[model samples]
Target chain A: MVLIYIDHSEKEIKKSSHEAISYGAAIAKQLGCSAEALLLGTVNDDLTTLGKLGASKVHQLNNESLNNFDAKVHASLIATTASNLNAEVIVFAHNINGKAIAPSVAVKLDAGIVTGACSLPSLQNGFEVTKTVFSGKAFASIKIETPKKVIAINQNSFGIQNYDSSATIEEMNLPIPTASVKVTNVNKIIGEIPLTEANLVVSGGRGLKGPENWGILLDLAKALGAATACSRPVSDSDWRPHHEHVGQTGIQIAPNLYIAIGISGAIQHLAGVNRSKTIVVINKDPEAPFFKAADYGVVGDAFEVVPAFTAAILKMKHNE
Target chain B: MNILVCISKTPDTTAKIAFTEGNTKFDENGVQWIINPYDEWYSLVRAIEIKEKDPTTNIHLITVGGPEAEPIIRKALALGGDEAIRVNSNSNDSYVIAQQIAAIAKQGAYDLIMTGKETIDYNSACIGSMLSAILDLPYVSLANHLEVNGNTATIQREIEGGEETNEVILPMIISCQKGMAEQRIPNMRGIMAARTKPLKVVDPVATNAHTSIKEFSLPPAKTGVKLIAPDQMEELVKLLKEEAKVI
Candidate 1:
């Protein structure tokens, strides 16, 4: 059976988890097995809604302790669950949680595993999985030669297919190990959408001159209802928070639409956003490296172009 | 305190990716190798932080690769590790790599195991998790902040939509990511110290798994941009509604 780990935070389904379900469902279809889900923590949404994403069953641990993630405890708990359910294949979104838990799950099960899988497995002969290599620069087909397998599917790599199937929500009586660490305090930046979940991202760079002018990018992001990002230099220089940085040295993202303003794409910078589906670059230099990577390019002053772009979007919304 | 950090050698970001004859293998010609960026930022840095926090701590670094990877392992040693171990194999599968590391880790009895959230080369952040399972240790991935106090560790991990804070006992595995630690540059002293560090090369243990790389390919080039005049807001809106279809 295909088991998918549903990653959520404080009651909201992660967009990436939906993609993982789609991927898990496809694998289940290919393997002629049922697709089941394992959720950690408390999510307020109706668990049955996962049926639309292709889960045949949803195994919920649902304890308050599970709400705060403890990787070691989580790995042990999941390993126990997987073994109990006799799971043949386990799936996770190649996002943060997947990266943490999937490998541990593989080791616990003594199973062969692949992470950042971009495509479905080719199961005609054996279980061959296709995954992105070289920082989204290429692809390689890997065959997992083990009785059981683990896969972490990348976000936006597989499209979620809507299916009309009902999934049963079952409560599992798994033991929750005591947490060894205590959270002293949490400093969360409110109001800003996490970059991974944002469909549209407005990013800036050194060309913004300083943090004072970051408002232009923020304005554009607000106008487009998007998240804001920055190149490594901007983050390193403290023009933006480190979490807002997207580059080889920062968070690699694959959003649907990424708008880069005033940033010249360095090789390191491109490594992060290269997987974005549609990239829009706004710069004064027509020959900037970012233009080569952008799906859309505008050669003009970001100071002038960004506001106009935001105004244009607002104006169009008003007209509508 | 004892720490283990996993590393992988990956192609440089600028390499033109291609497949070999009949798409059977990755075309490695003309490709330059570097330490996987994520591993460098997350795993390596976190290990260094532990070492720096406690002067008596021993940081051991390991990689599952062939003889050609010795220089990279040495470089990692230069970066701050006290010793190095290289499993003599070329296994690209995460499971195999985890098995190799787990074997070494079990023998060394390290208190903490760390790896990158995902290697930038394959972007597969699965090794740490797999190793945790193999070793029967708790595993946490994408830990941006980690602090060890006595026998426990407080880790802040990035979740799908937000962050989740947790505390776990040590002797567990952690996959590091952004904000774990600042990147470190190898100074002259570090470079010299790395050359003198002990690097043990061991043959990979035999395994029944016969995982193989069947083929390789490149993603299709992105389509050209649909340019809209600066003043054509209606046309742009129409395109977003119809052609682009992202509205």
Candidate 2:
């Protein structure tokens, strides 16, 4: 059987988890097996809805301690669950939590593991998988030779499909281990869409001059209902928060539409946002390297172009 | 008061990526290698900061690679480590690398193990977690802020949409990233001192790589961009809506 690990935060399921379930279900179909889901901790979301994404059954471990993430504890329980269920393949979303836990589980199960996988495995060629390497600059095809394999799919890399079925939720009681780590505080960004889950992102850079000039960029982001981000320099200079920084050393996002303004795209910055489905670069300099990587380019000062662009969008919305 | 910092040598961040041997291997021609930035700027420096505060804390550097990794380890030592160790083997497999480090770490009996969040080349952020699993130690990853007090370490890590603060006991593994510490350059005195530091090279233990790279390929090049006039905002809006269908 193929088992998918469902990741959630604050009682809500992450969008990337749906993609993992869909990917796992397709893999199970390829291997002629059943697809199931392993969800740790309690969530307010309905479990039956997971079947629509692909899982045939959902297993829930309802221990309250499981709500807080402890990589060691999570790995041990996940390894046990996979072993008891005779799962030949395991899948997870290569997000923050998955990146921290998947390898430990793989070590426990003695399974071949692939992280940041962007493509489904090809069984015809002995379970070959493709993943982005060199910071999304290139791709590498890897073959997992172990009998038990673990794969973590990259966010936004796979499509989620809806099916006309509901999954049976089975509540399982498992012994919880003592958590070695204690989470004392959590500071969440409220009222704004997270960059990882945002479909559209508007990012600014040093060319915007300083923190005071971010109003135009924020205005556009607000008008479009998109998330806001900044280049590394912008964040380093304190014009934006560190969490809003999107680059190789910061957060890497692959939104559907990414708008870069006043930012001369450096290779490090491009490594993070190059995977966007559609890229639009706006800069006063016509020779910026970002233009080469963008799908659309506009050579103009962001101060003038952004407000005009936002107005045009508002006008279109008013007409619609 | 012992800390083991793991570092790796990787091609400079700005180096152009290319494959050789029919895309089966990375082409190293004309490539300049440096200690991975995350390792040098964050993990290593953070360890040094802790040592500066406690003076008795010992910082040891470790790398798993061939002899070519020696220079990188020496440079890391100059930053503030007491000694260095290089496992005499090189592999792209994370499992093999983690196993070798775990073997040495078990013998060293260090109180804390540290590594960068991930290498820029392969970007596999698993070594710390895997090592923790192998040694049955606690693991904290992507820690941006760390404060060590006695046997407890308070760490702040980035989550999907928030920052989470956790406290873990000593004898744990952590992967560090930006905001942990400022990058420190090796001065002339530190460089002269690093020459006399002890660097031990040990043979790797027997292990099998679970996965093998079959081929490499570059991402498809972007098509030529459609340049829109700055004044034609309405037209750009139409293109995004009707042509790109992204708005």
The number of the candidate with the highest DockQ is: 2
Q: Which candidate ranks first by lDDT, i.e. highest?
A: 2
Question: Native contacts retained per candidate?
Answer: 0.61, 0.79
Q: Pick the candidate with the highest TM-score.
A: 2
B-chain TM-score, every candidate? 0.95, 0.98
Worst 10 residues of 2 chain B by lDDT: B123-132
lDDT of 2 by residue, B127-241 (tens): 9889978999999999999999999999999888888999999989999988999878999988999999999999999999999999999999998999999999999889989
**Residue B10's lDDT in candidate 1:** 79
TM-score of each: 0.92, 0.99
> What class would a CAPRI assessor give candidate 2's docking?
high
lDDT of each: 0.80, 0.93
After superposition, candidate 1 runs with Cα above 4 Å error: A180-184, B160-164
How far is each candidate from the true structure, as Cα RMSD in Å?
2.5, 1.0
The DockQ of predicted model 2 stands at 0.82
- What would the per-residue lDDT of candidate 1 be over residues B9-113, giving only the tens digit for each residue? 877767667777998766789988887767786688788878787998999889999988887888788888899999999977666777798899999878898
